[model samples]
Target: MYKLSIKKIIRLAAVTLITCSLFSCMSDKSEQSKSFSVQITDKPLTFCNPITLDFGTDRARRAGEAVVAIHQDDYYLFITGLRGYWYSGNMRDWTYVDAPDIPGGCPSVASDGERLIVSGDKSRRDVYASADPKSGVWEKVGYYDREYGDADMFIDDDGRYYMYWGWSQILPFQVVELDPDNGFKEKGKPVTLFFGDYKSHGFERRRPEDVIFSIFSYRDYLPEENPWIEGPWMVKHNGKYYLQYAAIGLELSTYSHGIYVADNPMGPFKYSPHNPLTFKTTGFMVGAGHGSTFHDKNGQLWTIVMIPSFYGGRGSGELALFPTAVDAEGVMHSNTEFGDYPQYYPGIKENAVANNFTGWMLLSNKKYVEVSSTLEGYGPEKAVDEYFLTHWCAATGDPGEYMKVDLGKICDIYAVQVNFDRHDAKLEMGRGFRMPPSLSQYQSYTVEVSGDNENWSMLIDKSNNTVDNRHDYTELAKPVKARYVKLTNVFTHDEGKFAVKDFRIFGNPDVAKFTKVKDIMVVRDPDDPCKAKLLWQPVDGADGYVVRYGIQPDKLYNDYLVYDDYTLDIHSLNRDQEYYFEVEAFDSGTDYFHEKTRQTMGIGAEIELFRDREMLARKMIVEGKNEYVFENIIPGTYQLRHTFGPNMWVGDLTKEQLIGSDNQVTLSEKISDLGVGTKVLGQLNIKVIPGKENGKFVVTLNYDKP
Candidate 1:
């Protein structure tokens, strides 16, 4: 499981005390110039999925199953996706700490209030022990030979330690009793715990493609029908043991933790009617399968699961928190459908109710971007795109760096999320072998809201903040009505290279209702099977529509928000895999009185193709290089479908091109260069005709797209 938590209970209850005065926009002007803030990690490493694991140093690290154990004093030790461990006062954000043990593959650790036991996935030969993991000094326990496909240790209330393990297409996941004193010796035979019937379990099927991995140590597998049920984790509540195992791979968009409930510590377990207790297949991101669950200081159930992320063709996933609950029927569920959408954070549930959304919509999503300065190709609009994978960065590393948004009008402001980003910070942090990961840099800034461009007041201040919160969601003590807001960074920890992933503001405005239209489904694009088309019945009172889709459920940052029809065409989809999408019908006043504009919108606006917005075409990312291979070509008119925008170019395919079967084709920069017909969208829509082999060709591009 991927969730980790260690906490010391603090009982300071109650927050909405009428002690402070409720403030309002009194002196600010009606129209003013202000700025907005977005939220982003300091540095992120993009993998096949790109967000496998995040190291503290602003460097994104790819990771697998992780564990969390209690540490001395109320601290929690986050065993990383890699070899080291991270420390956190709160389970949300963490700091890095190094250990002497070898790191590779999935590792597991467990704590029994006082001491801890651990194991790594490599070899699966031995276990380790430590009285104080905070010190990072652990002694070897013992070696074992029989087997442990994957190791996850669990300590019962009575002090008994049980180890669950497995991961394979052919083998079943299992669990066995262990002797904690003797390096967790096998006290009993390992029993097969889960071999779900994928025939009836739709969620257990493997991804549409093979386990085509390149980022991790393990890669390449022929995909079949049955799925890989790995990462066994057991948690007991009310005498019922819940056996959770991760199912499917890149299918996290539809992946889940097949849940099985047992009467005794051992078998005779039955599938929970609520199987896949933690399952979410739609939204910005894809998967919520392999992760860990824990109780917070207040004893509320919470699970941290890996976020399914795909960029290029490889699946590099990340982790996020999923608020959980066990109903009266004793069923557990991970509230993940709106997992990536803006919602009240989990830690504050103690002071607020489970549902704390104020119905405030994203006020500046995709708003025009204004900046003090910008880096090459990093447009201002990126700061407001709402996609976590993209960001808007300043050109120079200097103080006073800022990004501003007009917001189109004055509105009541409620909250702001500042997404900080790290781009090539490793070049400056001095990379070394097997070093612990942590963020050493910090930002200290002041946000001033204004009504007029000239007049301003401090709305929020963090100049003296000693804490580092990655997703800094700041809510005013009370709603502050304002028109303009400006964020000025007076200081930074490292070189002041100002960066932000998004500047999102939530507010109460003349908002349109989201027409949760029915009849939702996805099919391969009829014209281009490589793409997808999402068609739904138009809402009776709706004016237009917005379609949001992506490889992951939580990171559905890619969108076609301006469509005004029932059917939406998505050309930017990853061809090798399936995707998740959401459709919303809106009556954004503009379509209300303007009859002519409304007449021209909707199905009539369907695009023939979405111009390439990708900085790079989808490819397979290896340890050191990204590979792009185009397979199966039919003889016909052909064009390299990619960005025709400025300063963008693709690698030459003439040399790296590979032909197989009856495939054949030529590489040229333009139609004139190919000595063929006229160019369309900057390149030739050349007639492929037919090849001597048949009527197809394949092209492979190496290095970066020009």
Candidate 2:
């Protein structure tokens, strides 16, 4: 007979108790059936990160330094190297329009309650304006005689215009007032605002863990660690001016944004306590810098930043968006925890504190995958590992090459994001160049779903697409129940291989929510304030945990995702700052809760050590921090059985004090013959460490298990 683990039985009892107590009854059939009815009522309005944009006809498929402007209830998106811009009425669907009059690289846009003014990076001095941006008509309205790197234009409440521009390792950010009445000419000399403080701020340093140093800084000419303070943006909130800029370097994953507040649009400014207003260095999408912020039609604030992808070449990337806000205490910050996951657009959920994350966990991360073919070092598993640096590439860009994901069970699939990476593509144009719209290549594919791995149904069909969509996102018209999802390649752009960085699936499993994570421990290094260690007790039914931390407990804006681990070491923190942390456990599509439905050995049942239904070793239940060593065994599948009794705990209580109950819960589905599949190459040790929970223990299975 198949035996269930003691931990699994206890969790089932806990869920049963909670459910019965909530309803105040257990025998009524109507009450029991109503409890399991669908909890979701509405189709969530959500968007995933690396915000899908019209990547244009660029050979490199890269964009960065994004800026967003709103005019006449419409949103305009401008990015580096694109010949034109994109406009969206609801921020979900964007339409691209060519701007022949405006030059491309690092463009910025600002609206003056009427016409929209646009400008480009350092070398492009000619400025353009459009009364109707959607119509694709722009006129050269102004020009700056002097070159300004990463320039941004701001129009204050009093109709005063100010221009902020600077991008240097040895220069501070500068701002000068512009006279809008006089062809947008400069009205005053540019004032040096501030420079990056790498010594005091560890996040401003140049490397992944903030360990590298640049040549020099503006204050001290001597060789020292320095950072380029670029991409200056301005926003006025409650009579306070918030000047934000990207720091470090664009190539590093730690590239982030910091904020400074002032009373005037161009004046003395102080760094906010929350130094890096936006930071996302640890998730599937990294780098939240060099972006623009704007208010939606519902008055909610949002920021769109650049996420790096240097595969095409250096300085290559896509864009991402996050919900941003300033608290009542005037603290400016952005919520980046699960920033790359599915999130509701503005006004869907009014509470900014809770964030807009749809709670649809990533279903395909590290799950079993099967592909039609693979190139060397580009395995199928890489496509679902939740990291952008790795991908799965088929041997050729053939029409029938496909990638499939096994969700392990039937799940409520809500959305799917397919991130196609450029692998061995024909280089039609180099960096900083745009291809003619007619020459732009298109990607065509079809997404299908299956339940029993044989019969399939179409989910998302883009086989006849004409647009250049690299990071394509599809929110299903209706959520479907599926066990397998497959993406078949109909066409690939530029004769590139069928490569995918991530085939992310979003959904919920048919299981109860995971219990809260407890016994969290944080140890900040006194010798090096930039580093810290976090440890927490593992929670049952959790596929992973998100560590949320920040300067204030109520303002834990930054977060990191840790999978299948109880401990983490963080190195991206400010040296001279204090932070508070909290961890939350989340359930994904691959959780082991499905085992609860499987039939198992009775309570207090002991298994005669078995191998393929044959006795092999003595019978005993290992408990506490004890070691168990089995004698020499053959290379075969072994069933590691466990049993539990009512009120049977594993903690500090003595065996005599434990009370046994008479309940015998029988599950319906029979458990499969699965166990520690291993070869007897060497001695393998399994350890059980008692956890703080009443009847739970941490099991460590050792072997060549990835």
Candidate 3:
């Protein structure tokens, strides 16, 4: 019989301290598959769902217009999230520069060839300057008399300082001359540069919760005619000036940004026909606006923008980076099309961003997995589904817990990104977590691959790694062919339960042909507010269908694969918001599911997102006495189900041993697992001799779905 050391289970238990406080904390495309110009990175950039901007101690999720500045020709990324600055020599690795005096949110900092000027959104336009911004050394230099809106300080080539600011629908993104010596005080009257045209420019219009009315009608405080035109940032490319600015309310999924160009830094700016260059129309994480553009060490142009998060603070939560380029015609274009996906960065001195793509599709996504332990919602699939928010945690906090996958075929493997899910707060609170030693980590692992299912080779060894890169991407210097890959835990960083979100394996399969999906459309179900219908023009020669959907187009966390139908009901979505989905028609049917392509990933089964909200079932052993008492079940009809099997032993329990059941319970034969999705609930106490060997069990309870 199983017993609880802690008699009172912590239901709705607060997420561990890590989840609350650790709010803290990409790619190459190329080749003849090179038909696609975008490149993938060794480290595919995933979405910042629960962004990693949580400061050292203040776990608040808030930030203003993100700023990317080059101080004295050095690349720096600064955000007012908790009012701290991050410095980077190579745009990839960043180090935090301590600046405890900087106020939170809506702060702007800029360099004037020699000095870095900093200002905030407070009533008084007090400014601070630093000769050495790299080290966070600043002293209040001067003050301006007027209280300004969200603004950007600019210094033209000829020692002239200017300020551009405004966000009122009636006002324009105004520009004014400033006196550099006196905190960039206004020297001339502000002139209207551009205005919001909500009527003509649909992106600038404020959406009234009417799109998904039923789900978002609770936003009753929305004011009409409140379109915004603010956050002015300027860039000088070639002989022309590009005036960039953000618009619309932050609440809209379509909140975006656009630009205007002119020959001189000041007058007659022409709006680019390609306005609203940066936007995120659909996804779990929406809106990318109010950002700045700058050059990296390589002089490669990059834009940093604000991305809204359901879990973030006011205005928005996290910042996303998108590489920008000026076309032959000199139109500056910010490539945010695949903004949330993994992207390759510009090399230290390449003329442009070189996408280094290893032609390998996701090889281990949704395939069968075997782990040392799993319980309740922390199922094994959580590690494969690519949802970092969920996880597969070991039942006990023990070392040597491992998860393995059988690829069915010996394939060429190149790279793997190991995303260890930090923590899953049973209780939603906040975050501040330092990885404890008891709940240590895999100090080292003898990552092995095998072809005969018996013989193995050490692919990569981390058996004594002192540094814990919780999210690690190991790009193999040489590709290896293997059918099975196993991550053996040699050690752990802590003594707590071990968990992981996904192990994204990259490798090529045998030759295959895949027909691209055409006319794929996602629309809300006419009869259901919570469901969306994805209809597509079926390809003539196709194996099956695969659909990936997420709030952010870059991170489609939810996926589905259908072998027989052209339609799918997306049952998992927040009614109040829109979602982004991309569909594909594959040539290999479910029979060849093991051979997944870049556009198509295996859809074994996506545990219902709602399941996480429901009461989880207890897991029992294959052969042993099992007693499970779900207290306060609240008197409801329930069904018994299993993860691996409703094994023969289940029938032996008999009627008396089954708790909370009155009628005779019949035992049914089970053939496959993952076929029985949800709506199965129950409580039982059974005993079986140690003879059965083909079953694994983890059960969950929930009300029947309509």
Candidate 4:
């Protein structure tokens, strides 16, 4: 009986031990799963079917340049160049609002959450305000004559309203404070922003004597002149104001648009180092200028500009909308194509507060670091600079995540560094982040800093690595006084888990001086034999040189010539005739242009014709839709030729077999030639299948000419 009782006790003990072990295993799995988790609820919002409004016939008298704005969920459009008319919509359709009883021929419009402000010329410069959209009543509260031209209004985050407009006929820009309650009144004296002479501003390019003075042609004293600044518009975002305006000059072919930026709405605005933010339709005779910018309901920013189909003619332009993104310097840049919406990565949400603070996410290492105050335990203390891993159960390999950090409080950062480590113990063959799949492997990493977490700046970027484990660093001169920092890995292999150790922010400040030019040289009409070679002294520290010369100082000159070498050869000139020339130097780091040198030259003789006809034939075959064959009877190593455009051709057919002794060869049928006059070569045609959420199109080009 004692032996049997001992056996029963032993059996019970074993069973209890087994149950406890099972429970421990289950709990461990649960904790691991939670650590490597992701939530898709934070994805960026997608918008489609943009609401478009036609004010009138494309060239109708009443149809003119228009500006669009969004308040709350309502879309308001202010069309000018007409007497005055407004339009309203709600993301779907637009309803025309009759012009208020105001007398503005070319009016500009803006909104400040409570009222819509329109400023333009009635009898003189005037400002009108309306609270309700349905009501057509507009009351004039302010007026300025000589101090304003084509005015625009902007309300900043601090509840301060500002108005930016052109000053005198010579000076093109001025800014003033506006009191919403008392209308937009002059808070202070108008500040003259940009002023320059007509020739320096590219106004009278061909004939200085035939200079045309319109509202668009004004003297802007700003440093750069690709497009002459006019028609000022302002928008404030994340504590910065962006001024988008029309730059009318012969350099940009007249009536083009560009952007400038300033910390405050008042004086001292700087043109974007990357100016001419957006290029209009190339040869469609489209003139893009006089635009306004606003944010949509989803917080996406868009710019509506007048891209008139009639350029160099006598008609108004149509209004087209383009998406824009702000950089670390608060400068705005538009995307390459129109109608292309900005894409948001998954696992990132707009206006999300982590630890009660709002910010945007920057992705890196297939993991996301939630760097916001809204996150639990996120504070000045107890904040761990570590990686937040995410699971890839639903997708192949490992998925990535993004987190936003507020940088308003932190300023003067020297360097930002990130360290990464793999998760698995044994190294796997395919283990890394991929950038766009076509490439073979991940090669580099880059770090960017931003003040508002919206506009990002590249602090350090490095590529071409041979080692599996390596450390990279980048030194920044401008110790970023930013609110956000993003680190990205440009690796495209198989996605796997990686670990980031810590982010180190240091303080180092070192600034560099801008370069200036000394002298320049130009060779006029070298090919025509009638032109002369012009020369000038080189500026110290200049990265490159630009030479501007033409037959007449004002019109039909060749495009500005850019060269890394000190000298330039201009091929546009008439023999025995004097031609004007100007040379400028550009600093590569800052992209600042030095003072220009002017000179004159005369053409003396003509040169021999050395046309690459064989190269031209190959270019033509590449550009034609149907397969082309070259047939001839010559057999003594004659050159095969192809022409893509009038002065452009492909040469040296030795790289690939052209044809047999019969001099006949058929081009590939699959090759797509975009026909003659198409500037875009080797473009990929993508057809979006209805209802498909994601797809990619890739195009490649090969050169057979040697």
Candidate 5:
């Protein structure tokens, strides 16, 4: 007979086991109780799925080198590297093409209907020839000795070929024209375009002579004033000449592009009031010069240019293609990555724009007034006053105070109104005033628009007017269009401080919307108990879902392990262990909007015990309450030996001896202790530690009674 110990009973009753944290139990009585070995599953963390495209044979050959152009139908790829030139079919299949005999290293390639032109560095400055695209053969037609390198070529509708080559070795704005018949002929000597002595000309100091031909002051040659102008590319669209070039330096931080309108290819040009068309963003850097323009098969205008990639060592650059759009006024606008190509990937969140004023301050004295929108109470107030100013101020003069807003889509704006307070007491009649004073002191403010925050338009002197003493509201009108708006102080008195409550603009709305997620579930595989399936419901209007999970609950929301499908299979899961998961929805129209779901946790089934393995035990002595305990007996029928109280275990003797309210017993017929098939109680041990302090203790107890 078997008996139970009071201590063991009390410990078992006190322990409240959580299924997810407990061990599994296996038993042989039921087929469903069979145990299977389990192992932990490894999940990957990444949102860039299909991140790598396998071009069968076209593996990237070298670091900083990539196949930029792929023409599968033509069986050719225009490959460019840091130092070499090659052509490949199907990317994987390659044949090295002889490097163009050029002096410089960074080469750019373009083609006319008649021949291919490779421009950059050494050998032939303007090398050209009608070579077989397949055989990699070049029949050198002509080499312009003076147009030595770093040149771009374009063919107009009139079948005229034009080349814009930089010639800074002579003068600042040296542009030589190349005629298909005579090559590069000097039309005019290099012209000095920009004023270099001004303190505002710091960006032009380190400009590369090889890339920048000249820097022209926009204010000198055009109706609308602009500062720096460089990196020129001439394109004829709808019979209008558009000279698109870089406005600032070639570096990522200060780089930007602009377009000038001209009727003649080589004559005077007018800087579009909408200059500096392309600006920088968090994901994109270096929006500068040395770019080319092209039209696709659909006649849509696109700019193929080089943009820097942070993945490259610092200061390194990469080439990118951006779609360009022009407004009715002929001003070109390049949309931000989030605004134009939002659906490039899944699980990517848009960076929030802050409207703090601490950084936008322009002060002659350190005692400037604190004029911020948040301090004056405004809706949608995530903007905070940061200690540091905009980085643009490091190079150019103060960019005036400004706010960054997510306009949602690509649109045009014509006018803007600002609410501000004058804070500086020592104010010059013509010079801009310093800051820090009461809001009531601000009498008037000025507003401007710029594709780039570094360069801005002059104040709308006509639009400048006084507002009420209670709250100042000023409207600035100049009939200008822009994607971004900036406001500055034009006139002030008595060291007054001004807070910009908000800037109202007249333009089209471009807002992005997000999709929503509904539900998620997990279940065991119907055909295989060793496997499990994770499933989720699709979000309304969502293009797909980004699902992520991990062993630790905290790591699940780290924006990793993104899956676009509705279900995933769990090949191996640890038994009696918990797992956590998270899901997010992605919209097809905009890549920035994502809705995340709450985290969920689940546990696997428990383990069971079998009788076949337990029957082999050698010891059969009952070790509990002596009143109900029994000694070993032969395998057979026996008379009633004893009776036990509730929660007691009986052993040996006849089957009747094991009968009790809460008693369990096993009868073994074989002589050697308990036979192999006999049932026995298993032991479970647990250790508890003090939650707040360092302490340890142990307790041991037997399972069944003797």
Candidate 6:
């Protein structure tokens, strides 16, 4: 039912022209003219991930659980908790449309080859139909009896409608056929599909520390130490059904999607050996889970997934798109390499998996930063740390507050993304934090560029802007040569202080990429196979390194980003899986050293470590340290228990609490009574000393186990 529009036709032609160079007609001795030879080039049509959108703000910025549905060759984007949806022709530019009558959160949209049907908001089962979604007109068509958490709606080639729903650590996904003629009622009994298999799949294991809320609060929904198998999406290809679901806690960096293939829509499915078809744990951006897949205007497969930002909080997220393909072996995979950087847009060239990256380097990471005024802990350097959770906040929202960055040298500045943050925001209740749905009442600012830091020219002047774009990204019409870039704040929201999370600038450094990283060593913890330590020699003139690893050498799907540090501790691995690792030193371009090794460590029931008590103030453990703030510097011995897990703290105690007891002190019996104290594994006799600043103390705890 879909027809090619003029816009799509022109876009396809443009992509073809950009990807293929038409040559002169071939000449032969036969005196006959042959058709022009079309040669394919590595030129990719690209777009950056964490796709830019006017995200809504509640307590913090929010947009996740995205579902993309195609109606008449147009794309409509639906997200969880967003009051409305977005419409796009090329999936790059989005126009938001508000529909008050429609429900929000965990939305599922499907087109029965003509009309688009939408259902969302776990509590609301009413199905809304929009013949023309771009018009924002809808009518109630059907309803279900109860809620469907993280539901997915799918229409088969045969025009049969199916509804899939489930979101629980203990429950399995269920699917049922829907009868459209009967108020979309179930046509048959619901069929249970699959449940979390943490024992068999390392990525599915749930870590208690990653829980966003109190573990007790989700007791009714999730079982302890079990992954939540949810977000079911079905894609039919080559007469086969591919059901994809997300596992691991959504709040964790390891959150990812796994696939199961079936011959029918309601499947008796088999898990794919390449379980996680889409995963990106490294780079500036993190997380690729709970997303939907759709074909673009040129029928190129692409997926839009939720990238957990955690800036707003636990469930806070943004959306990203990756190119996907089904290989000759019928295995489906997504291109997540250099995921956060610029990638070719869909239909730009063939084999998106190989020619995706645009090779634009990160030009403003850990660079020199200057700001007008700074809050106590929110220094200007936080703005370019490549971490979204931390931000540099000005003391006030007053005009003239600004932040500037020097990229070390004159570099080609092609794009800039200014990520604003919510610092000291005062909102009413949970909904008090408001980003105008009408795309108004946002920040007003101007971006200026300079080659010599003194003479500046306006690059992007949104001084009187009205749009509420917190994560604002702009691609320049042409690359500009500059070393100094500054953003002057004109006005900010009244409730929040002026804060910038990441002042990212991307372009080429006009230099050669760093050489392949060498002298790499990987050691797996004997006690905990899930943990591994990687140490490598730092490459000179390298921006950073990407440590890629996987179960096999050819499928190194997992990547972790490391900046400046020569050592990395990886806590996100399977307990009983062999992994191959390769380190790539990347600057403007990339280089790799493919290597594999098998290492192991031994687990112990109990272990002990001793540090000099005299040098406690200066000496600390290498694992991790805890900071405590008080009215004055506390000089005393502290008894802190270090657990076996990563960054796990058993308890905190002062000198008074440890006066009577010795090394086996009983600080809090509450944890012991719960029978969960056995995991403590060891303890640390930490002594607090005066920190670099008064009223601050640091207690470093090194684990005795691993």
Best-to-worst order by TM-score is 2, 6, 3, 1, 4, 5
* Total colliding residue pairs, candidate 1: 44
Error of 2 at 566 (Å): 2.8
Please provide, for model 3 over 1-706, each residue's C-alpha lDDT reduced to its tens digit, 9 standing for 90 to 100: 0000111111110000000010000122211111223222444222222124323222223444778788775566666534456655444445556665554446677788788778865564778887876666677777766766876778888878888777676877778888977666788787877787654454566655512211244556445655778778888776678888887755555556778899877667887654555665532235667888886655567667765533201123455555565655565655443232233443422323223112244566566677877767787766766443456777754557888876657777876656554343232223212222221323356678888868988888877654434345565777898878887666544344566666656566243235546577777765544467778888764545556554444333334445556887654344444567766665421122332221133222112111223433543422111223332222223344444434322223322233433323232233232212353322223221111221222222222321
Instruction: Using TM-score as the measure, name the better of candidate 1 and candidate 4.
Output: 1
Off by over 4 Å in 5: 1-110, 122-126, 147-149, 159-161, 167-171, 183-230, 284-289, 311-313, 337-706
Over 130-181, each residue of candidate 6 has an lDDT whose tens digit, in order, gives 8877667788999986688888889899989999887997889889999988
Residues 656-687, candidate 1: write the lDDT tens digits. Answer: 23333344445423222211124221222222
For this target, which candidate reaches the highest lDDT against the unseen true structure?
Answer: 2
lDDT of 4 by residue, 1-706 (tens): 0000001010000000000111111111110111212222321222111112332212122223456676545676666544344443332234545554655555667776777777776356677777864456777766653445666777777788777776233566777776666545567667766652333223212232212222244663343432245667787766666777675532232344566677777858765544445443221123345667666554545555654322111223344444554533344554322121112211122211111011111112111234212222222111122211111111111222222333324455644434333333133322112112233333245567787657787776644433232112222444456656664545423343333333333331222222324454444443454435656676765534444343343321122323335554432233434555555553322222221121012111111112242321232222112122232222123332122223212222231233333323322222233322434334312111111221111122332321
How does residue 331 of candidate 2 score in lDDT?
Answer: 77
Error at 67, model 6, angstroms = 0.5
| Per-prediction TM-score to the true structure, in the order listed | 0.59, 0.74, 0.60, 0.39, 0.36, 0.72
Candidate 3, residue 398: the lDDT equals 57
Q: Residue 453 deviation, candidate 1, in Å?
A: 4.5
Clashes of each: 44, 0, 49, 46, 57, 9
Model 5's number of clashes is 57
Question: What does candidate 4 score on TM?
Answer: 0.39
Tell me the alpha-carbon RMSD of every candidate: 17.7, 16.6, 13.7, 26.9, 33.4, 15.9
Candidate 4: residue 650 lDDT (0-100): 21
Worst 10 residues of 4 by lDDT: 10-19
